[model samples]
Target: MSATVSREGNASVAGVNGPVLGDADFRFLREFVLQHCGIALSEQKRQLVQGRLLRRLRALNMKDFGSYCDLLRRDPDGEMGDLASAISTNVTSFFRESHHYDLLEKTLIPQWLAHKRRQGDRLRIWSAGCSTGEEPYALAMVLAEALEKHGAPFDAKILATDLSPQALQGAREGVYSLDKMDGISAERRRRWFLRGEGSYEGLACIHPRLRELVTIQPLNLLHDWPMAGLFDAIFCRNVVIYFDKPTKERLFSRYAKQLEPEGYLFLGHSESMHGLSDDFDLVGRTVYRKRAS
Candidate 1:
């Protein structure tokens, strides 16, 4: 369905040096994004969406939002990735929500390893919506430290996926500005990163050992997921807050199905599965364990 733009009542604000995003354009883009990515753009986000897509309009030499929307509709498969990249927020840092990592190192890993030791099973982690690389890299660091402490070879891998190809490319590159290392400890910085030099000065790259454990891929959570095995832990923090309630419920249910029995699911501090899904029991602050039925 096409959105109708009204000419009256301040329906559009003329953007700086460009065409304003009219009411109809905002409506269309919002629905399009939600339909394609399951990310609901609330009325409050109209300005934010306008600002983010302004650059795309300029890049495409489009005069207005209408043209942009038409382009998206015409070549959705080719342009959807760019639209996703434009609208997706990729703000992230190393070891964000430090308490989650603490829980991983001090509680979850120990318990998981004890059980896996008996079964000779490997650890599998999914960093859903892993923006750039920080979250998965932080997970890899924790696993690496735990493996060193255990003093035994334990097979483990982290699957880091995001919808934005641009973000995934950055994640795969595994490089970051030196300032972004603030959340990371000196010990970790020394052990897990290679400081850049010359033209690459003031940058850090994740050490090969840690990078080896993470596999980065582009994935849309709303689409068919090709993964076959259940994950021991899934880190989907700060992602579902952008989705509507039904989307959140469906996604949480999917996560529950993908998690091993008694496996953990970590959410952002602002998110919860309390009213959305019953398949998981609250085990920690914003942490849930799959109910073993």
Candidate 2:
């Protein structure tokens, strides 16, 4: 699976101090990213990609982009996460898009819980591209509160997944600095997070209850999914902005298949499904409901 890329074009340019991403390597990387992650890197993003991936190169102790491309060609799965992480922004916060959570908390969870009251019934939510845990923990807090409020014996769980190994580790740790707590309300802060004491001051740790509700794992959305059942709702906010149109269409189609009938799909504020998907109908701001088959 090794790709043959010419290394003779390597040189410093455009203030890229380290191994400049030569044209050949850049082309290979662009295709590699699009093929594996569904992120279309345009020519305009060349310098940015070069800048961001320099850190990856430094971390891997690699001298040039050609070798890096070779590594990816040889072992794509092993290095894909780091490569994706290097190129993509994982900036996220608790309740990053409050409106989506509002819809979930106020309407969806309650309705789903009511309907799934039987002994074997279950409620499931998937946080696709759940970077650094905030999204899923926020989801957990909402689900936890709803279950407590409903006072019902029911099974509920959230699946939080991402391609970045580093981000998944952070999500698993469930710890964050005080600054990252802005989007979380004071009441939720008091209820769902524990303040780190003494030497660990200024840090917030997620409540054990939230940890119990959320299961964090490594997943690449473009790859084969192992999930067997349909989800009541899925939060894929801010993750698809990097994808091209065809990628978005394919991803949305897969999402439709993964959702329960008339299930919800939440997207980032800046994203839209207009003309990209027919499986969903826009029901709210960046909120879509799976069409009945």
Candidate 3:
């Protein structure tokens, strides 16, 4: 719920003034985040919900959590998109959970290359919940070089999406602070990042060519996915952790449908194929392949 907490006491994203969650407040948080962003907060994790949403209350100028929830309900347009953006967890970077990328580069890409070697074409992967675009941009830069080495008669494109317009804007701009790329390889760093210059110096941006390979767009994962054709791979890592199990099952099933036969699915490291479906077969840590049926 949106609360106009007193802009009092210490202030931070995690800190806010609000009535602690009681039965009604817990229900409100669960319903609100779910309706807006498809996140299902659990009873055990009620405090986590309170902490994360408190910041939003402050931003919306709601005097308390009740008023915040009221605003979400009253806004027919469902300003929940903004709230959804805030609520959705997006802690990812270029080549996160390195082993996944390692497999993509070492094993999967080679397999795709072998199958497609006879035909000159383009490779397409969708990075759902692409956040600030680093993941796709890094993929583009790295994969391009890999393709060149393989002499595959093809290029690659990464479709990056997020539910947040703010995140999408950051992705489209392809800009980053230094910390965003610490995990990137030095060679990759040199090739993909352009050093900031002058007053804007110290910041870095994805090289324009790499930026061009990724098409950034705003997308609500809980809503219709606008593109067509199955992807060669889908990198929706770390995104489903906030969604409840039912939502994860449904979302992953949708992901299975959009993937090409044998296309890859990557999830957060802590996430598992457990209780999801037999539709995907786990091939590596958090890496999955669509089952043949």
Candidate 4:
């Protein structure tokens, strides 16, 4: 038999049964999430949302989805971040997209270092939506290796930003299980990570030098960005696919403005900027270079 609500309005589907996330609740959450974080949710995602937020409902002792929505309206800070965290997909690994690193090492870094050497300048890279730190840390490793190979003392730093505080906390910790090192070479792993021992055996933490090269910050791309300087390259992979077309257009435009004239922008393998913005030209697979004007 289908679960029925008690007179007290306590959730009928609590525990193993799961909360009943109705159409109204799904609509409310969809609109709220899109308005706040620009993450558009389709009707098909109703089940997905219900599954992701069931724990939140149980955590708050909410009797119904309406109560959760009311809580959101009354105290957004109390639940919004958690909601974002629950909804965010943080699947990443060290050097998940090896080709991007190859481009950074073979072409982008070398050319930019040559120009910067002439100007006596430092390099800046932004890893927008850098969930759990892998992307930025990979960039750091590649940059460090390239600098060492070139025998140059060029200053460089990476700004890694994400909307989820939970993910940022993991990024800041810079620790991961040993199995997550599959993509990293033994030499690279030895150079960039410290093997954890004792109770922390089977884990690894990024070395001090690599950690120092990346700064993790909590940022919502839909909100105001306080960064002042332009970037030499911006890696915003796998991020905008969740946003609507208009949101994507505005963000791509903003990235163009924030990038140097010759700067590069990298997107996920499944994402493209073909109709989003004309300020950048497609130069490589899932990569764009800002037009020289």
List CA RMSD, all candidates: 3.5, 3.5, 5.1, 2.8
Residue 7, model 1: lDDT of: 40
TM-score of each: 0.92, 0.94, 0.84, 0.92
lDDT of 2 by residue, 47-82 (tens): 899889989888999877877888999999999999
Q: After superposition on all CA atoms, how large is the RMSD of candidate 1?
A: 3.5
- lDDT, candidate 1, 1-293, per-residue tens: 13334444324445455667787778888899898878888888877888889999889998678888889889886787778888877778998999999999998888888889889998999999998899999999999998888889988899999888788888998989988999999999999999888877889988999888999988889888999999999999988988888899899989989999888999999998878998998988898989998
| Per-residue lDDT of candidate 3, residues 168-272 (tens digit) | 788887778888878887888888778988865889877877866778878878878878878889988878877777888888899999998888898888778
Model 2: residue 208 alpha-carbon error in angstroms: 0.4
lDDT of 4: 0.87
lDDT (Cα atoms) of all candidates against the true structure:
0.87, 0.90, 0.75, 0.87
Among the numbered candidates, top TM-score falls to 2
* Number of clashes recorded per candidate: 0, 0, 9, 0
Better of 1 and 3 by lDDT: 1
Error of 2 at 221 (Å): 0.7
Superposition error at 273 for model 1 (Å): 1.2
| Better candidate number, 1 or 3, judged by TM-score | 1
User: Looking at candidate 1, what is the lDDT of residue 87?
Assistant: 80
For candidate 3, the 10 contiguous residues with the lowest summed lDDT are 6-15
TM-score quality measure for candidate 1 = 0.92
